[model samples]
Structures are given as C-alpha cells and as structure tokens.
Target: MKRTKKERQQLLQETISENPFITDEELAEKFQVSIQTIRLDRLELSIPELRERIKNVAAKQFEENVKSLSLEEVVGEIIDIETDRYAISIFDVKEEHVFARNAIARGHHLFAQANSLAVAVIDAEVVLTAKASIQYVRPVRLGERVVAKAKVNEISAARTIVEVISSVGNETVFMGTFNMHRSM
Candidate 1:
C-alpha cells in the first residue's frame, strides 16, 4: 500500500530528527522514494540540506561558546598545532558526506576541511578563502577516518598561503593549497 504525502513527511521528520546526519540516498531508500523525491520533501519543509544543517548547528554552538573551536563549522577537528601557522585535523567519512556512489566524499567537504584549518591557524577575527587548488589522489571509503595536515607555506601582509595534506590510513587521499586573506 502507498502512503500519503503527509505520512511520508512525518516519517522524514522523525528520521531526520533521530539522525540528522543521514544522507538523502539513505532516506530515499528508507522511505521507498526517489532521492529527488526526498530532496523535494526537504525543500518543501524548509529544511536545509545535511551540510547546511551541520553548518548551522556548528555556528549556533560556536556562538554559545566562543572559546571552543567550531569543528563542525569546518566539519573536522584540530588534532595538533604548531604555532599559528600550522595544524592537523582528523575527519571521518560518513553517509552525510557522500554525494555519489561508493564512499567518495563531496569535494566541498574536503575543501571546507582544508580551508577551515587554514582559517583556524590565523589569529584574526575574520578570514576568507581567497583561492584553492585541490587534487584527489584516491577515493575515501565510507566510515574511513582520514587525517588532514596544513602548514603555512607563505604569508604576506594581507594574505597567507597554506598547504593541506589529507590521508586515509597510510595512503594519501587528497592534497590542497589554500590562499586565505585576513580582514581588518
């Protein structure tokens, strides 16, 4: 028997509330609907996508506690740091991070993770991504944990260049160079 739209909407809300990190594909499968259908439902409900929701939550949490770093804002946590120009972070690839088949994470997540690390190393209150170049070396499988290390390669009066290296286990999965600008 087919369920009504209201029933589907209620089910979606319950599922999302229980696990806000679930992917659209997973929800589609669970609800016996198409991924596009699920997306439409989310749009109709004024619910942001998984990434946006995560960012919002991170922003809210950060606002509440200014002392703590918003790891979720970058979607990764700093594991180590060397002065104000270098740091390392670790992130796990989950369903919410995947946009396509297999365990490959969305490119934006990789970019954000690297960019956020570069920004975090700055002592200023505002930082922006000026430019970036990223190369995907290998596919990161779902549930695999990866490490991201960034270093300040060069710094000028207005901008800083940072290099990021990401690896899954011992194998290098992605690498990036980010140029960040600090505003006064």
Candidate 2:
C-alpha cells in the first residue's frame, strides 16, 4: 500500500529517530522511494545526514563517558562508550587498510580499533594496554565494516582487564583480551 506524504514523513521521522546511523540510500530502499525523496523529506524535517548524526551522538556520549583517549585518537568512529563498562566502535576497511594483492585488511588495523576502544572505556586519567592476547578468526576484505565491542571484565586498583571482539556482521573477525594499566 502507498502512504500519503504526511504519513511517509512521519514514518521517516520515527525510523531515523530509532537508528540515527541509517543512510539515505537505506531509507530510500526501505521506503520504496527515490533517494531524492528521502533527501527532500530529511530537509523538510530538519534532519541531519548520517555522518552528522553519528558525530553528534558520539560527541555527546564521549564528553561524559570516555576518559582515557581523545575522540581524534580513536582508530574508528566510536558510537557508544561507558567508562569502566563497555564501548563500541565501527571501522570501515578501506583500500589503504588492505593489501593490494589480496584486498584483505591487515591485522594491525583491527587490533588498533579494539585496543583504542579498550582504552577509551577505562575510567582513569591514564590508561595503557600492558599485555594483549589476540586471535584472528577470519580475513576481512576491503570495504567491509568491522564493529568492535569492548567490555571491561575486571578492574583493580592498578589494572583493568578488557575483552574486545570485532565482527563483520554475525561472524567474528578478531578477538582480544587486553590487560590495561590504569592510574588515577
């Protein structure tokens, strides 16, 4: 069934509110409309684009939550962070991150994405990964987006244990256990 202009706009507002990271192209596909229509609807509704939305959310969340690393120092776009709890980030595998011959992303990029997030979740003035045990489950290809989730498993006066798992969709690409040194 077709929805009226008002109804479509209302639904667009709800959809974008629920998932601010959704792109215009995805909205267009879901609403069965052209990308131009989504853009027009967004303009009329005063909704910013996906990049701006992500930046806005990240900025607000990071200000009060992340303590160890500045936003610019993060290896990827951090979508959520809770100090001494859990945090999540997204890294898009680009051509520069992959080997030219295989188009497979290098392992260090994934490690950095997870390691930075581990540090970001520490509720301390200074934080550093003192030891790490990591496993690479699969090779991520160029253009794949990796979502890294880090959780604080334990915390002591002088150390924190963080578990980080990175995935492309439902499949795990890499996993790491980081022992971080923290100082108040």
Candidate 3:
C-alpha cells in the first residue's frame, strides 16, 4: 500500500520521534523510499541529522543531569542518563577503534565506553572507579554499533556498584562490574 505525501510525512515524524537514534538509511528502508526522500522529509520537518541530534541530546542531558563528569569525559554518545540510577550510551566501532589486520575492535574502547557510562550514572560530585571486573564475550568488528547500558546495582555511603553490559544487537560483546567511590 502506498501512502500519500501527507500521510508519509506524518508517519515519518512519528517514527523519528519514537527512536531518535535511527539512521536515515534505516528510515528509508522501513518507509520503502529512497534515502534522499527521508533526508528531504527530515529537512522539511526541521529535524536534525543523527549526529546533531545525538550531540544536542547528550549536551542537554549531561548539563542538566550528570553531576559526576562533563560531557567530553563520557565515552560514546550518551542517549539517556539518570543520575544514581541508570545510563545508556552508543559507541560506533570505526577504523580507529578496530585493528587494521583483523578489523576487530580493541577491548579498551569497549571498556572505556562502559566505564564512562558507569561514572556518568553516579549522582555524586566526584566519582572514581576503584575496581573493575570485565569480560569480553565476543569480538566486535568494525562498523558495529555497541550499546552500553549501565545500572546502579547498589549504593553505599562511600561506594557504588555499577553493572555495565555492552552489546551488539542481542549478543553481549562486553560486560563489567565497576566499583565506584563516590565522594560526598
């Protein structure tokens, strides 16, 4: 079934609203239209590109929500953050993140993405990772998008335990338990 121009535009707005991280290519594929058409629809609707949208959301959320660190200190694009509760970020493995020979992403990048999210989820003025136990479940290839989700498992007066899991789709690529010191 074909949708009218107005109908398509309305649905496009709804789709983008539902998932701001969606790419133009994904939208085009879902709507059964050219990428150019999605671009045009987004432009006419005054929606920014994925990069700008991520930056805008991260900046706003970091400034208003995160107390442990600045925006630049956090790794990846932080899509959601609730201090002392939970936080989520998306890391795209690029050429710099992967080894040239194997095209597999280095472990440190995944660790950094998860570690930073753990810190960002803390509500204290100063938060530091005192200890971490991590496991690399699978090798993430270049161009894979890593979604790191952090949750505060327990919080003491001077310490917090954060559990972070980084995944590509439904498969876990990395998982870590970070013990953080929160200075009051």
Candidate 4:
C-alpha cells in the first residue's frame, strides 16, 4: 500500500536520521515513491542534501582541529576527520587513474590517498611520514569510489602511528600503517 504523505515524510526523516549519507534515489526506492517526492519531502523537512550534510558534519567535526595540511592537499575529498585521531576520505577513480589496457587503477593513486590522509590527521603544523608499510589486497578498477579511513593508533611527542585502510564497497583494497614524525 502507498504510504500517506505525512506517514512517508515521518518515515523519511527517521531513515535519514539514522543514515545521513542515504541518497534521495535510495530513499525513493525504499519508499516506493518518485525521487521528486523524496526531494520535496527533504526540502519540507529542512534536511540538506547528501553533499551538504557531509560538509556540515565534517566542518563541525574538524574545523579547527586539523593543522597539518590544508584540506585541498589531502589527495581525496575528506568526508570526516577528527584531528590526531581518525579521518575518512573518498576518491573517485577516473580513466586517468587507471591503466589504459587493464582498467585497473594505479597503486600510487591509492597510496597517495592513504598517505595524504595519514598526514592530514595529524594535529601538528609539520607532519611527515617517516615510514610506511603498505599492502594492496585487491585490484581496484576504473570508476570505483575508494573510501580511505585513517585511524591514529598511537601518538607521542616525537612521532605518531596511523593505520589506513582503503576500501571499495565493503572490500578492502589497500591497507597501510604510517609512522609519522611531527615537529611542533
């Protein structure tokens, strides 16, 4: 049965509240309604779009806490960050990121994404990767969206340890642990 507008709106609010990253298309499919209806419902509820919600959450979480690198230098778009603790970034693999013949992404791109994220999570003005141990678990193809999560496992006055795991969907494609040196 089709849900009444008020009922659907209430359900939509609850769904989005549970998962702010839910897309309008997904909500539309779940509600058995048109995407336009979902958009209208969201607008009426004063809920921002996915991108806006992500930005808002990230800004609120990491505004002044990240001091190591500017946001633009982080290689991928940072979706979440808690300085000196954890960070998450997303990188969309395009044609340029892949090998022309195989359509498999170059390993360096994944490394850069993880490395930059590790650097970005430090709470110091000067941060550098003193060493890293990395492994590629699977081959990522072109057009894949890779999400990298970096968590700081240990921190000292001289150095910090950050572990980064990059995934496509639920499968981990790359993993790395970075030993970072922080100066001041």
Candidate 5:
C-alpha cells in the first residue's frame, strides 16, 4: 500500500503529537522516508523543526505557569537594576531577529526587551502585560548593542505603569509606556 503526501503528513503530525521529542531520523526510519522528506512534511504542515517545536512548547508552558515577563531569545539580558527602574540588555539585530528585512529588528523583540525590564523592576512574584504604547524613534541596525531601561512611573491596585527607554550607545532608539498587572 502507498500513502499520499497528505496522508504521510497526517501520520507525521500524529506521531509528533504523540511524541514530540522524537528525532527526525527516527521518524524517517519509522515512516520509511528520508530525513529530508520528513523535514519537508513538517514544513508543509507549518510545523517547526523538532527543537523549535520543543522551544515553542516550553514557552507556552512557561507563560501558563508564570505571569512574569517572558523575554524571547532575541532579547539578551539584564545589565543593570535600580530600585524602581531596571535596564535590559540586547545584542544587535540579527538575521534571526528580522522578518521583513535584514535591517530592522522585529518590533516584537523591542517590545519583549522593554516589557521584560518593566516586569523585572516590579517587586512581585509574577507580572503580566496589560497594555503598552511604544514609539519607534529610530531603527536599530544590525550589530548595535542596545539597552532598555524601564521605570515604574505609577502603581494602582490592578496595574502598574512603566516607562521604558531603549538606547543604542548614546542614541535613543525606542521608548514606551507599559501597563503591567500582577497575577497574585
């Protein structure tokens, strides 16, 4: 018996859903297909590679389990911290961070850096983004290390307003105000 590409893809998706950690080579062997074929099937189904799928699942789990600001890989680290304000760190925009073109850092990465820093400054176990108004003052070029600083501007029982500034060296690149809410 032979299966169509769609059938094979369905089987592959089922196999992946049952055991997401299964290797491509293992899946290929089980499906009697080449590794490249398995990869193509995954791509056709809009499924990420095994590692990426794992990371996605992990990110989802983290989001569900904690209310803290979750920075994606594109945003790097925490460089400095003040009592009510903190600075987040990021490396230059790279191929991985760009979508439409290689020149601009995707907006989500900028948001993540600022939001993460805002959450980091809050004295709470978990924080969630309620709203944000960001202004792209300047485009962040590739290879430019930037810093995002967030300050707690105001606090209420339900929300905290944070002011975030992102700068590359001495040049201000972006700025925003974020509303964060605590889960508990």
Candidate 6:
C-alpha cells in the first residue's frame, strides 16, 4: 500500500533520528520514493543533508569525549557512543570500497571499521590495537551499509578487550575481538 505524505514524512523523521548519518540516496531506497521526493520532504521538514548531519554528529562526538582517537580517524560515521562502554558506527560500501571485479568489499575495510571502533570506545589519552581476532562471515557488496557495534568486554589499568560485530542489514558480515593497549 502506498503511504500518504504525512505518514512517509513521519517515518522519515524517525528513521533519520535513528541513523542520522543516512544519505538521501539510502533514504530514497528505503522509502521507495524518488531521491527528489526525499529531498523535498527533507526541505519541507527542515532536515539537513547527510554531510551536515555528519558534521553535527562529529561535533557532538567530540563533546561526548571520545578520548582515545580523533573522530575523523574512525573508519565510519559514529552514530552513538559512550567512551569505555559501547559505540556504534555506520559504513556505507561504495565503488572504491569494493573490488572492481565482483563488487565485493575488501576485508580490511570491515576490519578497520571494527578495529577503529574498538579504539574509539576506550577511555584513554592514547589507544592502540595490540592484537585482533577477526572473522569475515560473508561478502558485502556495493551500496550496502555496514553497521559496526563495539562493546568493551573487559578492562584493566593498561589494557582492554573489545568485541566488535559488523552487520549488513540483519546479517553478520564481520566480527572482531580487539585487545587494545591504553596509556594510563
């Protein structure tokens, strides 16, 4: 059934609230509407573009005190985070991220997303990945969005253990356990 403009606009707000880093193209696909329609709805609703949303989020993350590393260095757009606990980031696979032949994303991109998230979750002045145990569950193709969630599983004065899971939609595509060293 086709949704009325009001319903679609309401849902759009909710969706963007949940994932502020979402691109207009992604929104168009999700809402099954034209990109121009999504843009018009956004303008009507006073919603900012994806770049602006990300800038706002980057500023907010800085305010939230992501101490270990700069927000810019992280592999994806971090949507939710609290240092020393958990963090969630979104990575959208594009042409450059995937192999030319099969359009499958390279393993290191997912690995970096998880590893950097693990570092970002640590409460420290300096953080480094000492070791990592990672698994690639499936191949992620072009245009897919990978959401990586990092949770600190253990901690000490000098070290920390974080578990990161990267998923495309509901399917797990990558998993990593990172042992990080932090300066006290």
Query: What overall lDDT goes with each candidate model?
Result: 0.78, 0.94, 0.92, 0.92, 0.74, 0.91
- Identify the superior model by TM-score, candidate 1 or candidate 5: 1
**Using alpha carbons, what is the TM-score of model 4?**
0.78
TM-score to native of every candidate shown: 0.59, 0.79, 0.77, 0.78, 0.56, 0.73
**Tens digit of per-residue lDDT, candidate 4, span 1-184:** 8789999999999999899889999999999989999999999999999999897777666667877777778788889998888999999999999999999999999999999999989989899999999999999998899999999999988999999999999999999999999998
Return the lDDT, model 4, position 15: 94
| Model 1: lDDT of residue 17 | 83
Question: What are the runs in model 4 whose C-alpha is more than 4 Å off?
Answer: 1-38, 43-47
Among all windows of 10 consecutive residues in model 1, the one with the lowest summed lDDT is 61-70
For candidate 5, what is the lDDT?
0.74
Ten-residue region with minimum lDDT total, candidate 3: 53-62
Which candidate number maximizes lDDT? Answer: 2
Better of 1 and 4 by TM-score: 4
lDDT of 2 at 23: 95
- Candidate closer to the true structure by TM-score (higher is better), 3 or 4: 4
Which one wins by lDDT: 5 or 6?
A: 6
Of candidates 2 and 1, the better by lDDT: 2
> Candidate 2: TM-score?
0.79
Local distance difference test, candidate 6: 0.91
Candidate 6 structure, TM-score to reference: 0.73
Measure candidate 5: CA RMSD: 11.1
Worst 10 residues of 5 by lDDT: 65-74
Model 2 scores a C-alpha lDDT of 0.94
lDDT of 1 by residue, 48-154 (tens): 89877655654554444323245456658665555346777778888999876666788778777877778776655677888888999987777888889989888
Q: Which of 4 and 6 is the better model by lDDT?
A: 4
